[model samples]
Target: MNDLELGVIGNCAVAALIDRDARVLWYCLPRFDGDPVFHALLGAPKDASDDGVFAIELEDHVHSWQSYVENTAVLQTELHGKQGSLRITDFAPRLFWRERLFYPQAIVRRLTPISGSPRIRIRLRPRFDYGASAPIRTYGSHHIRYVGPSATIRLTTNAPIDFIRDETFFNLRAPIDLILGPDETLQEGVVETAGRLEERTTDYWRNWTHRLAIPFEFQDAVIRAAVTLKLCTYEPTGAIVAALTTSIPEGPGTQRNWDYRFCWLRDSYFVVRALNRLSAVRKMENYFRWLMNVVASLHETDIQPVYGIGLESALVERTVPGLPGYRGMGPVRVGNQAYEHSQHDNCGNVILGVAQMFVDRRLLSPPGHEDFLRLEELGRKALQLYDKPDAGMWEYRTRASIHTTSSLMCWAAADRLARIAGHIGETQRAGEWRSHADRMKQVILERSWSHKRQSFVESFDGEFLDAGVLLMTEVGFIDPHDPRMAATVKQLEKVLGRGPHMMRYEAADDFGMPGTAFNTCSFWRIDALARMGRVEEAREYFEEMLKLRNRLGLMSEDVDPKTGEMWGNYPQTYSLVGIVNCAMRLTRSWESVT
Candidate 1:
């Protein structure tokens, strides 16, 4: 059965998820927010050879082993059979060519026999319009073109065209390379192009990872998390998408699924900040530019929480007609409605996301006085709406509340603006922003504190517990030694703990109670525990959370704490960010690395 146990392979331009048996399950064509070409991650309804997958099946298959090539996004999945074994090397070519980054909209797979003669069948199916239509296929001597409604994809392979077309088993006597890319013909032979690109792509990734100032311990986990977050970024615009897949449900048999393929301002804030910790500032500088465009285009308080990676705003949510959801769950969705949400925190997240650029000299293009004036526009909105009602960070659809998370982020925006102004010798402006920040912080502490429950609550006068309150400590709003900080942590554990994982909150929403623990919140709990002087306990929980990763050391959006099964969107950026943040917080200093 297909699960979230998949390895991701991609350059920044395009990404695909492959299962342990080397099935290309989920691949979006052309771009990250584009149509899904291979939709097997969300199963198709009509099963006449299953219309939305690409796979290589070995005869009498017995077992499979899969992993990423070390320090790289390239994936190698080896299938073992009674007769013999074979390996499939999959990657998207990314390297510097002709003095510019050359990452094409292509996926390359090389198949080689590792043992005695093995027989295999190639299943290359491509769908369009969210699995609503199958592409019309036409082939030449060495390539096949899949013509679709919006785009055309070409499959250029070195294997026998008749064998692939007839779906017949063939003896794996020699190596074959399959290049799935644009409709244009290749300029070189399949073997030559694939070989040069594969070697260069591997080198590019290893070189990138080598530069990261990783944590002394958990180096492997941190490297994988860093790589995964880098993959989430859209290089052309610097917008980081929340995840690769669209409508994987948060839990089983629940209508909690939402398309996470778009860029969320709140999520992008965390992603850029986490990468900045590893000394990878390109994403930050790039994302800062993206944020500037987003803020500049808007007139006033009309900003959105989410948007297309290409900076297109209006993401109208709708369900498609044909494809079944993941694991036979229905209602496959395409666009997201969160763009229409009054998240209220968008201004603050954007400000916080790019605040480092104002003060850090390491950036190539630092924000100037004009940029600070632009950021001040967002600060004004943050202060105006910090006490109003809106969707919280979790984006609850049915209800709007004066969320503490919203208020806290607004405070963070103001606080950071004060720091930035002070850094640039604007003392008067610094004092004015500092006054606004203090006022919001005092109000949040007073209104969000629930004396009845003796802990910080989700919203004003609310009694329900939420894991988001943990950010009070994370964002440096609350002193770690404060008694309420301890009380809030203790109360959260009492209410939201599910085995080793932690739920986002205890309150039921439009979908009733959530059934799974959010993966990011579990890591937040570990961060809170480590800060509360429970280092040993936090270490144990961190170990448990690391065990939650799928075989490729990857995480999704949520998990069934009862079953230890992943259940949300594949390769969530938020969940992966947690891995890097916690590793940085929990590891010993580099001074002691020797």
Candidate 2:
């Protein structure tokens, strides 16, 4: 079966997922939202084998192991056979050159035989435009080019071009270098370029890891998660994609698949917050600039739930009929229509991400008066929409309700703006923002609380339970010690919790009941439990959640509560953030080790 124990290798420009046996199964070109150069991950059920895959196969393969080179996006897979053993090192070249980041839309694969003669076959079948067409190939003495409708990629390698073109096996006598990238030919020799990039990329990542303030416990896991998050970020525009691939269903046959290639304001807020915990705020600072551009672009328009990485506003979602979905699940999709939905909490999330600039002394360009004025515009929108009806964070398709989580975030926006105002010594503006926040809080307390249900409800004056409101404590909407919060947690778990996993909610919407538990909701539950002094229980539950991760310590958007099968998009940013946040919360302090 196709699995997500897949290792990811990429620069911020583009990424690809390689399976345990060193097959490039999924990759988007030029940018995160670009067309799939490799579509094997979404291969049809009938074609179970590598249909559109780029793989290096060892003859009579017996044993295989895969891992990242320490603190780097480079992936190493060791394959052993009875005759010999070889190592495959894969990475997308990203390193500092001439005092700037040199991240290209390229992949570098180096094959080295570590033992006796190991023969291997090269299968490079790249599909284009979502597997709708095959590339027309042409070759030179040292390179082969695949030209498709949308893009063209060149394979520059030291290996025999005829052998690679014909998909034949050859003996591994010496090191072979394959650089798949833009159609242009490289000036330097293939071996020299690959060697230089591998060395510099290693240094770049190790330097980055050295600067992070990771906790002593689970340092490897934390670093891996952090690296994955960084790989998801599109550095050109400072937009971080939720995941590299789209149409990986939330659960099997649930039809809960949605495209996550675009940036959601709400998700970005959590991403920056989690990275900030590790003292990695460079991405956050760049993201702040991006958010500023996004907010400025919407001079009069209301903020949407998601936007294109380049801040393109219109994302009319549609299914790609040509490609079967992941594991032959149909309805492969692209372009999320949630961009058109009215997710009122969006303004609050944008403001929250931007508010970080005013306080972090490390930032070179902190928020000035004009920045505060622009934020006040978002604050006004939050206050205007807090009590209004629209889709909540889950982006329910069929209905609209006064979601309590939306209101709480609006309260957060106002609360933070007020604090920001005070920090700038704008006492009058501070008081005004505070008054708005207070009013929103009072209304939320009055409407969302359910005395009959003995808990806070999902929506205003509705008794439905939602896992989102369990974040009341984490977001500072309510103290964990408060009886109402405790009651809400208890009732939420009763309704949504299955073992250690928690469903986002219980109600049906555009789809039927969710088949898998939303991973981040459970992590939020862990945080809430920790804040409520259920540390022992929280630790036990955290361990349970950890078991749900794949062998690589990676998670998807959701997991089957019964089968523990990972579902939804692979290496989801929200899921990764959950891992980092929960680890930081539950791990013993560094001083304890001292």
Candidate 3:
């Protein structure tokens, strides 16, 4: 399926999903949360088709191969036919120009013939209002403008405008450049401008990648994951989205799809941590600003689980009626309603993210006393809410449990705050924070343990085993060598682990059974095994999980255990974070590589 065979190109401003054959299947304009200009990834049905897709299809398509330019977001797709072969180099213009970051909300698709003549057709179908209406088209000598209900998109190309407008086939004569961007007239010729931008963009990315501190093993995979994480960041606000796409189902024909094009405190925390390991501190600095603004915007101490990339608090989830779901699955959702849920893990996550600013002396400006004081507000909230029942990390709507993971994060928050207070010379405050952490840990240790289940249950006094508890050792809730932690890991593996994959939890949520295994949960198990001195087993498991990644070494949020098909949103940050974290923990010393 084209959905599985996709590569992404972006410039931290906007992104597009292009299939193996160099077709722009899905792209939102202006920003990640903006209207879908090319929405064909979510096909209409078997009977009809959706507009807003850009594709250059060869008459007799034989084979295709796609890959990213090394250490860059640029993608190259090669298509072959009996007649001839063609290559399309795609990228969004992002480079240092005039001593400033020049990132435009545009996609550059440069098509060149490699062999003999090939017949090709250009289909530039753009819709507006989330595929609700088709755009009205008008063309000139070298440009075409599609005016939609809300915004207009212009396509400037060196190719014949008549052939493109009429969707007619033409023989490959020379290289053509198509610059699809905001509704603006191009002053320069297409080929010349695009050629310069491509070279500059390539240079810019290579320079950025050169600065990363990657592990010895899995260097290529780590670099790709790092670049993908950079693309997910919204440079304007420094808010990193959970994923680029809105609603790709977690499982086939299951209504478990949810919009992920928003900032989640928990998810961003892991993202910042992963980037920190790579020494990509610029993203952490930008995300710190985004986090501070989110904290400032909240009226109460209760922070929502998720927010819009622009820090818009009211992310009321709703279904868009027009466009069919990914693979025609239905009920395509836009905004996520998880914002309304009170996930107690949020405050702890924010503190954990902020704690880095205080401790990391390598940062340009290490956090001071004032920053610590600001974080104390969240620490207090975590101390108060950790034991109370809420939606938990999974964002369950039907039932609320005093989730052990939530309680454990509460302890982590208080513990970090206590340390931060000590760093700022607030000994009295440090002691108080430590007291709160100790109290929360006591309650969790006493209440979350189940005698009959022989493990730490999902929630207080419950028999359900959640894969989330597999993080107990990683999060410092318990020592990896502790019997209780070992039992919890073994029990979770029995309940949630299917081969190498692990489910977040087997218990039914607002939906029914989860169709696929959560990607990060399995990685946590690997980390736990390494910490517990099971290094060889952890390495074996880690390698198996790595093999499940797509050809581009990218992963989605979930994977069907039965089949290796990836599900959920494309190139999810959580899945990528797992790759980086596992690689770091499992890699040998840098001295060996040296």
Model number with the top lDDT: 1
Q: If ranked by TM-score, best first, what sequence of candidates would result?
A: 1, 2, 3
Off by over 4 Å in 2: 44-50
Alpha-carbon lDDT, every model: 0.90, 0.88, 0.88
Q: Is candidate 2 or candidate 3 better by lDDT?
A: 2
After the best TM-score superposition of candidate 2, give how far the Cα of residue 124 lies from its true spot, in angstroms: 0.9
Q: What's the lDDT of the predicted structure labeled candidate 1?
A: 0.90
TM-score of each: 0.98, 0.98, 0.97
Which residue pairs in candidate 3 collide?
52-125
Least accurate stretch of 10 residues (summed lDDT) in model 2? 43-52
> Compared with the true structure, what per-residue lDDT tens digits does model 1 show for residues 348-440?
798889888987888779889999998898899898999999989888888999999999998998998999999999999999999999999
**Residues 423-516, candidate 3, lDDT per residue (tens digit)?**
7789999999999988888889989999998899889999888888876787788889999988888888888888888899868888888979
- Give me candidate 3's TM-score against the actual structure: 0.97
Rank ordering of all candidates by lDDT, starting from the highest: 1, 2, 3
Candidate 3 segments exceeding 4 Å error: 45-50, 590-594
> TM-score of the candidate numbered 1?
0.98
